[model samples]
Target: MENTKSRKQPSTVFAVVSFIAIVAVLIIMINLGVNTTLSVFAGVIMAVIVTALLGIPWKETEKNIISVAADCMPTFLIVIMVGMLVGIWMASGTVPSLMYYGMQIISPKILVPLAFVLCGLTSEFTGTSFGSVATMGLAMVGIASTTSIPIPLVVGAIVSGAWLGDKMSPLSDTTNLASGVSKVGLYDHIHSMMYTTLPAGIVALILFTIAGLHYGGNMDTAQQQLIMNTLADNFHISLILILPCILVILISVFRLPSLLGMGLAVVISTIFGLVFQGVGFVQLMDYAFNGFSIKTGVAIVDPMLNRGGVLSMSELLVTFMIASVMGAIITTSGILDVLAKNVLLKFIKNKSILVLVTLIYCYIVNFLTAGGQTVAIIVTEQTFETTYKDMNISRRVLSRTLEDAGTLSAPIVPWGVATIYVMGVLGCSNAYIPYAWFIFIVPIFSMVCAITGIGMWDADEKPLRTKKA
Candidate 1:
């Protein structure tokens, strides 16, 4: 304790300056066309400088950086596992089968809700919201043209469903990133989010049904049927292909290690590919590492299926490592501690306000960076991490809240990266933004849970303010 007292804490202004400098470097580097890993590394360098200014020695900081990296090793492995699982599952005909069957759910009465479900399932299956938008979303928008339903509403359902699955799916880089940042088990993080996500999903579906039922007549399903036929022609589609996904879910449900589950699924999927798809072992291994590729001769279907590999998700290795350094530096140099004690603890009177501020900051970062969900999640998670601990709130809350605002808010921002891509793919406009109900609905549930203490499980010390009785 005497040795601890010898170290000086950074002042509030210094802490604030350190944070701003890191964020500025990140934003500038990204805008200048730097890759995400390098941008985060730049921010990490800024943090190292701040730590030096705080009078911490270089050796100690280096150790802290390595320790942070080491701590993240499991999550890193899980991310790779997720990627491999996706690739092999695709090769084994799992993903294609899901897509083919999901397309069968569309009917005139529930066209809007079907679009949302189909997009959500596609994204969840393949773990690519952008792909889902380009494929399912494109088809949904095309079919809507033959109906009286508003284009914006169909686009909104597509956007909401795509983002919702991206936010929740284990295969998503963003989801795993959130899990790693908050230091929770991958499945634990996903399960925790269901508190907010499940209800929001239900509400969004109800609204879509109500809005779409009046206009759900005489719609053409030509594009949908074409895509299904393309999938059928390319691969043997079957319900048995769903076992891989079910295996992952059972792993989550039974509280098994995610790595074991993912690895097991990869092995099982490899066997399935051999037995059912007649894919060779060496070729399957190649797909596992490099991702699956196929020429279905369809514009959207090809892009959607040409995804998932260890290399595809390897970019996170550097990004997560560097982002961990940023978190460790600010934490070790007492930057976040100072900021929290002097500022956050003062303004954030209770858990409700704390949760609200986190949600807003996530949105702000996403908006300012024009859809840097990785930046938004990692930065906000680091900034609020220790504060959540101090307030006796779980860090899981921080992860879930960031996802609610960061991931969901991405496509809704008219000029954001996600929205731009969606527009380019579907030829839709900002008219879809207002109808993206899941984005709007989830945050409301997050706030309500904050106020009511519904999902706000206790951590350690009692909070300054208690939840409503």
Candidate 2:
């Protein structure tokens, strides 16, 4: 009893210490105006210190550290590959062609909402937010600049749409990861998500439409046409560029592994680059490593288009490392267990409180770790598995909660991977966007569904009941 009590005490101490440290770092980060990467690194270091001081075995802690690193490797590799693919696609005129056509169809009044809709379509088809952002999203930035619309608003629309598609699309890696982690069927998961996702999307569209109607008339047609023409002249725009996008969509619709599908798309793009764009073997290699650049003699255009490379992976990697380590510490030291038992579960009684508390906890975890949506889902799954099971809630309920809070809220947090990347690409400050309707609305919508018991099913509540043993 003495030894067991001693162990419990250290665990309790560690939980308290880590929680305090995390709060302190959040306050300091806010005061200092530090970016998410720095804040996450500080939190991780503090967590490690707390864990050590509380007597977590060094070997056990080290194992978790290594596991975090290994789990993150696929993301790092995907980031690098995506960067290279973007570079090549840009150089080959694939993205430019799509943009040229997109610009022709867009009117100033519909630009903002259209940006959302278009990005949503592309991300759905491609099953990649990063790929959509690199290609057509970059074009939208140019279009937004020409139209005098706020960049952050445009970025918000883009992110909102991109993530919407990511959540719904069968091909998205995160979508697969979420379902896989929850042990839910892919179709069932996608279907279940729609209850929350569709409403959020509709709300987002309405908001973007209203904003567009107010700001669309101020767009400069001459400048927009000029940008389109410049893109057209720089790269060979044609019907063929659409093929790679189609291939991506088809593969995704079939629900193949995302890596394999994306790899196939890359191969198709490379072939097109060689045959139609006259890209040489040497240039192809360079584009994959260093990214593609267009010397358009236009200063803004050059920088806007000349991005994406293997080197771009470093910053994201650093942020992930810090966030993952912090998460590892939090889990290993039993901080989450303590919080779940003493605070969250204690206060959560019925479905309303359950949903709200889960949402709050998921968001807090996402904010503290600065990790992506996948990490958020992983944490929530582990943290709430028992609670959810005990409450007789279907795993889909937890999955829905994860997406509503974790996936949608990621882009709003300044330090989160989605927010940071969008800001970097669009050159928009996080605070400039007054309203992110989708991010704000999805959680509310999800909770309402939960409270009403519209989408939830108790484990034993199924119609085709199993016989008792």
Candidate 3:
């Protein structure tokens, strides 16, 4: 873990070949329809070969790997904590109450835009699109299914809202990751993203509103009302069920570590489960491990509420481990160093070109990697960190652009994990791609800002004008 930097940099040929090999393994395995964790594991294997080819000893490389992967222990802990929080929230009827009350006031007239807003708020507080999808998104999709509104369009709005909030939320893994990798302040990274994200959010809201008006709420609501009634009868629906959510917002406002915040919040939610839901400590522990399960007699609500638990994130945890190993190998072998300095840097000409190239790389990686934002952000930020510094560009710009391209690209790509997850949860297809307003809008805003030099800050975070020429 100490100064293992004494290893020689891999030659250009070795570096390029190694990089391409790992990328090929990822793209091929992913496209071949293999499990995502397996695909990433293959990439890790390819990484091991790359290190061996470069004559880096396994001992030194292993140490380097552990050193790098250890940095993510906190992130991993946060993920587990989020899982526990989700499970406890469900058991405590917190999520159920939100869905219940949400369905209470939802005017079908504005359901489209309201779905977007509700998903956004849910994702904002929960810090995971998966969490929002499991709770609010499922509820919205259930209501939409009971209506004449297009399911694909509603799913699109839901995806937009989920990712929009995720990109901005401080507790989001991807958001924190982009900032961490680029060495930007978390708040500063979120602030810098406003340039692209703000416009995109507004445009998405307006588009959804127009669609809502066009749809016009012409639906039979007896079933929707029945579902709401079912929720009311089963779960304890009260204003106090929302304390867990309030705790999350307070944690964010206080700018505490997500792992610590989520840990404390999970405890509070566990108490709520015991006090409000009449769950025993052992039963709560079971829920913590295997997720909450309840038979509400409503087909939709049961599945939606059945989603959280530490074990539920097994695939995601494995993917993180694989990503960490692959990333560590790339760093330890020094190939990334050679490629960035000798190859990538040679092509970077100016601010606009740099931003464009970065964005393209991110999107391509995102699509090829099946929409894992962590890998995309890591590779792009590491590849360009020196280039940005050399060009006097702020790292915050890197963080912002990473989200605009990488995070946003996830839900839009048909083969992406995020897109597939959304489709599965919403019981829809790739048809939602055309309607993910916010995800698509940010890229346009990003490109325009790059060309116009708007929001392009210098290394000092000072406003600067870039010559488009």
Strongest candidate by lDDT: 3
lDDT-best of 1 and 3: 3
Task: Please provide, for model 2 over 114-163, each residue's C-alpha lDDT reduced to its tens digit, 9 standing for 90 to 100.
Answer: 88888899888877787676656777876777776777778878888887
RMSD of each: 7.4, 4.1, 4.5
Candidate 3 differs from the real structure by a C-alpha RMSD in angstroms, to one decimal, of: 4.5
Local distance difference test scores for all models: 0.75, 0.73, 0.77
- Poorest 10 consecutive residues by lDDT, candidate 2: 460-469
Candidate 1 backbone collisions, by pair: none
How well does candidate 3 score on lDDT at residue 261? 67
Ranking by TM-score: 2, 3, 1
TM-scores for the candidates = 0.66, 0.88, 0.79
> Which pairs clash in model 2?
none
Number of the top candidate by TM-score? 2
Q: Candidate 1 at residue 458, lDDT?
A: 60
* Local accuracy of candidate 1 as per-residue lDDT tens digits, 1-469: 5445555678888877876776777668767877766776676677778876766877777787787668667666866776677678778998777666655755656878988998898778656686566456755765565456888899999999999888988888789889998988888789879989999999999999988887786555776677778888888889998787767656645656657867788899999999989999999999998988898878967765776677766655555555666656655777655655576657787789999888877775664444557767877787788878887787778888989897888787544556655654565666899999999999999988888787777675233235651
> Which pairs of residues have clashing backbones in candidate 3?
none
